[model samples]
Target: MNWMDTIENNNSVEPIEFNVVKVDHNISLAEAIQLSVEKSGYEVEFIETFYGIEMDIKIPFLVGTEDDMINVNITRDDYTITIDIDIRRPNTIEEKLDILEYVNDNNGFISFSWNNEEELSLISIWMSRERLDAVDMLLEHRLINIEMGNAYVNDDKELIQEKLAQRGELEVYRDEDLEFNLSGEWNATHGFEYRYILRDINELINAIQEERENILRFT
Candidate 1:
């Protein structure tokens, strides 16, 4: 079954009610993040930070097994609030390549950065209070697939070949429709960086749905 089916069929996991609100410019970023977490029915454990507040939050919808606990780190700069999670650590070159392909295909809701020294891939979603609900949905969908072990690497070569062929056929139109641009350089020493900007919540949700269709088509 696809992700939406999985979400519908599974009743053990409680649905999180995302309290989307316009971010008050007067309030601090830490307070904003904390309020969001609390509204979602999770306790926020604040981690001391020099600039903005850093905290660990557990997203219940993303948890699969008893041992599965997704760690979400929230931080902020002068302008934006950043939510970062370590999605996966690739053990082989093929796995890393698979992740890169996935990132290229579905970068609308999240941007990715790689750590060469640690072999870690970080999935980051930028959010404003107004777009928090959409961001939360996108984040949950991505993490659920990751936990299922099918978001990135596929062991079936035939399926991979079919997906590549399908993608090749749609390349021109997809490029025109999405109008995505790649900016940044990859270095052996410094690793890689990729970022994408979404204008609004509709754009983000569309990206997530398109990505889901891609996965379902292959499977």
Candidate 2:
């Protein structure tokens, strides 16, 4: 079943749909749509809709913070992306069963919203299966000499620092337990570029191997 069907059948909540942009002389709606899709790392296929032209794409959604796969359609009408969330509160056994059915029909989750205050930041693209498998193989064989370059500090630094302060470890990492060292660079889109230096290589290797199942599972 499609997301619209799921939302209508399972719950009464209507899908959120709003125009993100209006066709203007400076930037055509098509151009804006193309840019959005490219930045999101998702391909678009144009289709006719009553409103106007629409672009269809599937994107990953997580059950919680952890990487759990659930699929939903991201249907774009000119400048708007329509989304329907599944199972807001699975309070009953029947709802749990419905969720299972939803998972079977949907490609991945669509836990998304337009964060107007923060700007439209595109989602993270999962690592390719080949790359993940190679990383897994390296870890299994105890090949710890590797570098992942840098990662963006996507979480809240201030909150994390406060927690560490309460624990009396104002420094987030001890010298010996420094699994990776962080360095920062400012970027307008992502905010900061935190470079990583793998100190505890074995630990990271183990993590990579353990988390391998999440890679390309939706596809």
Candidate 3:
């Protein structure tokens, strides 16, 4: 069965575990990056510019039923790989704090910056060649974080919670454990939303992994 069918057939109550493909550490950083993206079923593009030749790759993620792209740039110097996703500026101090906290929490792998002139918030993931195997996981994480950033932009509390839970930043209660009070509070009424969000997130993750596996299988 295909990945979607696999997701549909998944009945286990455990978290999904992904298999890491072994990468050759002896290879040059550029070659390692090229191999990793290629193995994940993405094409590596070489573009000529005034500075030098640059490597670029575009990966897709799902937003509702629509697809969005995340651009990854790989450079040889210092073996750095940069992933960039632009989000809207936060409208409130609370929103700004939320974004800052998320970045600080994942500071080892992510950083946030705002372009006041451009009126945009930039979320970036940086990694060295040593963590080459983590590229896929980081890509997935970045996409979820982008969704969270946009959630803040749109002032979507439910979506923000869902994204935080997906990243394990927030606690999620089991269906049986949720105690609903009659006050119609946010937690009481929306506690069950996370279950559905988790289900969708799992499906999206599985779909991405399947796409990579299919690409590797034929190539």
lDDT of each: 0.36, 0.28, 0.36
User: Which should have the higher TM-score, number 2 or number 3?
Assistant: 3
Clashing pairs in 3: none
**Model 1, poorest ten-residue lDDT window?**
187-196
TM-score of each: 0.38, 0.22, 0.37
Residue clash pairs of candidate 2: 70-108, 70-109, 71-107, 71-108, 71-109, 72-108
TM-score-based ranking: 1, 3, 2
Best by TM-score: 1
Clashing pairs counted in every model: 0, 6, 0
Candidate 1 vs candidate 2: the TM-score winner is: 1
Candidate 1 lDDT over 8-34, as tens digits, reads 323343334334334424343334445
What digit string (tens of lDDT, one per residue) describes model 2 on residues 83-180? 32222333466644544553444332212221112323222222111111223233345443223422112222332233323332212323333211
107: Cα error in model 3, Å: 0.8
What would the per-residue lDDT of candidate 3 be over residues 1-219, giving only the tens digit for each residue? Answer: 321121232323233322223442333223433454576675556553443235555444321111233333332111234544454466677656655664566444223333333555555544433111122244345643554454231233454454445434212212322211111222321233323222332343344343332222211
